[model samples]
Target: MFRTFVSGLILLLPLIITLAVVAWLGQFIIDYVGPSSIVGHALTTIGFSFSASQIVAYVIGLIVFLAVVYLLGLAVESRLRSHLSQFLDSTMRRIPVIGNLYDLIQRFVALMDKNDVEGLKSMSPVWCFFGGLDGAATLALLPTPEPIMVGDKAYHAVLVPSAPLPVGGCLIYVPAEWVQQADVGVDKLVSIYVSMGVTSPLKIPPLPGPGPRKGNLTAT
Candidate 1:
């Protein structure tokens, strides 16, 4: 009976833990800056009370954060963002431990925002093809170039990411011809990768081939 209970818990633990953490964070924020009784009393005498307006501040903060993000996205395209990011990065790099953490976070955010077609084009799937059949493989993009000289044949570099997670991986430079485009959208490919290949898009069946006519010979 204990073993069975443990097995069931193991199955549902991740989802339960996720919800618990979300709830805790929400409550923590709400309690930390929520209106106090004194503020509530002052507002109440002045036509508002903490009990009546406690949620207003939290709601405003959330709205402001979202609005800022939306406005930044509208105003700044990749080129602009890249320039701004470089400036910020340079400033951050001057700091100590914070600089390293900032750079790591910046790289993560850049990878996550690869929805732009130009950015998406740089990322290609690393296929493991054999005899006209291609199965499990990884996708990657070239964020930086590395110069390589193999027996006097010099070449640039490419970054190859492991499957399921692009951020955790290495960089290697294969010949340009070897890296072929998968022609898949970055969003869809990310979904497939995150789900570990379970979430594939629906395939369309080919049109039927021409078949010999059976009836209607009388008209001919």
Candidate 2:
């Protein structure tokens, strides 16, 4: 019986959550705009009181909600977006630890925007092989296009972003040969990490065996 109940609950959870959300939307509208509030009283003047003004009010509320969201979307595409983003950046950067966090998030958000990854010109997705050419590979981002010369050996700085967050991680310096070009975009890479690898990337391309391919050692 317990097993049956658990299985049943699992099957019904999605529907239950959907209905709960819809009911909450209805109640919120009734409380603020449509039926119980002044807007509800105004709606009554238009004979909107079906089912004691609840169902009709909820419909109106849903329409209003969609309109507000559409307007916000339009605003995001306008000049106001740049000003608002700059204001947010300056304001958020004043809050110490949170400011640092906001900067990280802001950079990632820019990466996700198809039209605005200019801020990440120095970064690119890569597969970092550990130990040697045939070693374990990791998904990472090159912090800079050029390799740093560390005592005659060239080392690349790669940032290994944390999974499910991708906002913070550790940076490591490795040989140029350890890094390979990953045929993935910033947004797709972020999505894969945020989903904890449940959303896998495309098939890995053929890599050189054992050591660096003579002409392919540069980080793209």
Model 2: per-residue lDDT, tens digit, 1-220? 9999999999999899779867976776668775557765655544443434666655665566678779977988997888877887899999989998787667656666677756555468888889876789888987566778789787787889887678767889978878877777777788888877978845766754544432454433
- For each candidate in turn, the TM-score is 0.39, 0.53
lDDT of 2 at 1: 100
Off by over 4 Å in 1: 1-86, 92-108, 114-137, 144-149, 152-156, 201-220
Residue 69, model 2: Cα distance from true site in angstroms? 14
Check candidate 2 and list the clashing pairs: 34-40
Clashing pairs in 1: 40-50, 43-48, 44-48
Per-residue lDDT tens digits of candidate 1, residues 83-188?
A: 7756877999889999977765565445567554444444343332222233333445534333355675543345555455655556565543333334455566
